[model samples]
Target: MKTKAVRLYGKNDLRLEEFELPPIKDDEILAQIISDSICMSSYKAAIQGEDHKRVPKDVSQNPVIIGHEFCGIILEVGDKWKHKFKPGMKFSIQPALNLKENPYAAPGYSFKYIGGSATHIIIPNEVMEQGCLLEYNGDAFFYGSLSEPMSCIIGAFKANYHTESGKYEHKMGIKEGGNMAILAGVGPMGLGAIDYALHADRKPKRLVVTDIDEARIKRAESLYRAEEARKNGVELIYVNTGTVSDPVKYLLDLTGGEGYDDVFVFAPVKAVVEQADKILAKDGCLNFFAGPTNPNFSAELNFYNVHYNSTHIVGTSGGNTEDMIDALRLMSEGRINPASMITHIGGLDCVVETTLHLPEIPGGKKLIYTNISMELTAISDFRKKGETSPLFAALADIVEKNNGLWCLEAERYLLENADKI
Candidate 1:
């Protein structure tokens, strides 16, 4: 089989090439990628190349695929896994393959033929053996692609533990009905965290999200209305910290000066991390959810609170398979709408440029259809692009009907109307 993919050759070296795929082995499965959402991690991998932990050391010769948040359909199933999987089944993969030999080896960063950027991929034996490939029954492939990122948010929530006054064992998860704050949290993953906190089983009584950008805060509020979150038993509040005189004091005042029980730092900035530390209540759990590129990233913390208030910190890189399952289940059940996370759409032809300069993009997630050939375009620009192209006109109309957010109808139209790769 032949596949077209965006491959990472070295630092800042990405090539869009068509190559022949080796025949599937007895333990391997063939898949056709439908949708893949570009991630910051992919950008880091593209820039760092061999320096990234997940990328193989000999990546210059043996290039790997460049996407991970993907979902697709099974084209062929090998004999070794015919009973468990069959042709035409939809699937999502948990890229965090914790192999003992290469602990950081993941699908998008480490593999040559199994990354999400390709039109088709060969799921290796180890993926199935490690139980990373999950069967997805969701209607939209984008939701399956989003499941991996949502799982990371879910993992952070689950990893956060609160303590009792006199108990030795730590209680898992954020405190139910407690005050929670997501600092610099108007970004894509931060939006996911807000959705989970509002709709998930464990509900926080008050949820405050902070961002320096007023535009992003407004966008997030428009997608997730405060009224809607209140109905779900959460008092959702979006604050532009840039406008506030003392952001920490203002945030603490929202919780009646008691401070927050769960504080999440979404930005890797040092000041953001310190802000999260300053607003912790007694037994508060600070979950640092951002991944920094710098190896020496550091921030000063209050040791007094650490020794007296029982405030502690925890960080998680990605979610486990079960967390991915939770994400899939939640989306399939129509409980969470991660569509709020995606801000742009494109095709396979745009992967190389987009991956190389993802940080420069202004919007949220950049979703790519691996089989199409369109350039990277923002959802906000659809109406403008519609003047010349009828395809975008129809897409803009559909997105407008869905309150200016990308929907399944938009995906159906784009894939059917756009030129195939």
Candidate 2:
């Protein structure tokens, strides 16, 4: 079968090409991709190409598709797995597949035949055997794509530690009923962390999210409403640190002299990292959430505090299978809303350009529906653009019906009328 995909050839070389897909093997399953959300990690993979650890060394020779956060419908299940797997089953992948203790070789970065940025993909035997393929029966398929990034937040919270008596051990999540802060960037990933922190089972008493961009921070506040958070017993504060003369002092004041119990550095900037470190209370866990692309990226830390005050630092690349499952379960149960992190939506045809200039784009998550072909449209613009464009008009009506938010109804409307647009 022929499929259209965004394939990586070498460093900074991504091509939108049509290629023939081999027949599904006995242990493989063919899936028709529904939605694929672009990630910052994919941006790094595009620039680093073969240099990326998960990307195949011979990527120049065997080009691989470059997307990991995606979900699809099972088109064909191999005969050997007929009972276990079936056609029409919906699934989201935990792409950080550490199969057989192999640290490398994930679907988006390494697998030549399997990726999310394509019309169709084949789930490999190893991925299935490791149970990385999660069956999703959500209202909207985009939830599957958003689950991967949401899982990263879940993993960060799960990996955060607190000292128990004499020794430090994993608390398996953020400090319950403690103050928390998300530093620097309130981009897509930061927004996810905020939603999780506010709505999770162990919700924080006070959550302060900081960003440099006033517009971005305001947009995040509108989406993840501070009023709603406060009503839910979380004292949510969104601050534009760029406006403040002293961001560290402002954040410290929000906690009433006591520093944040858990501080998350959402930006790769060294200054933000340093500031996040300084605002940590005793036994505070500083999570370096954003992965820095530069190998020489270093920030000065108060090691004295680390030694004496039980302040610790940790970083994680991606989430585990359990984290992915937890994210999905929460989204399904309406405990968390991953859709708020999405601002723009496009089709698979825009994957190449979107992947190449993702950093330049200002919006949150740019979701691509593989079956459709359309330009990226902001959900916020639907109402205004609805005046001229009938397509946007329909979308505006749908979003309006769903409290001016992109929900399952809006997704279904867009998919049903994708050709009309």
True-structure RMSD, every candidate: 0.7, 1.7
The candidate that wins on TM-score is 1
Instruction: Give model 1's TM-score versus the native structure.
Output: 0.99
Residue pairs with clashing backbones, model 1: none
Tell me how far the alpha carbon of residue 295 in candidate 2 is from the true structure, in angstroms, after superposition: 1.2
Q: Model 2 over residues 275-393: C-alpha lDDT tens digits?
A: 99999999899999888889999999999998898889999778999999999999999988877778888888888888888889887999988888888888888878889989899
Q: Which ranges of candidate 2 are over 4 A from the true structure?
A: 168-170, 383-387
Candidate 1 yields a Cα-based lDDT of: 0.94
Worst 10 residues of 2 by lDDT: 164-173
RMSD of 1: 0.7
Reference-based TM-score of each model: 0.99, 0.96
Model 1, range 244-267, lDDT digits (tens) per residue?
A: 999999999999999999999999
**Candidate 1, which segments miss by more than 4 Å at Cα?**
none
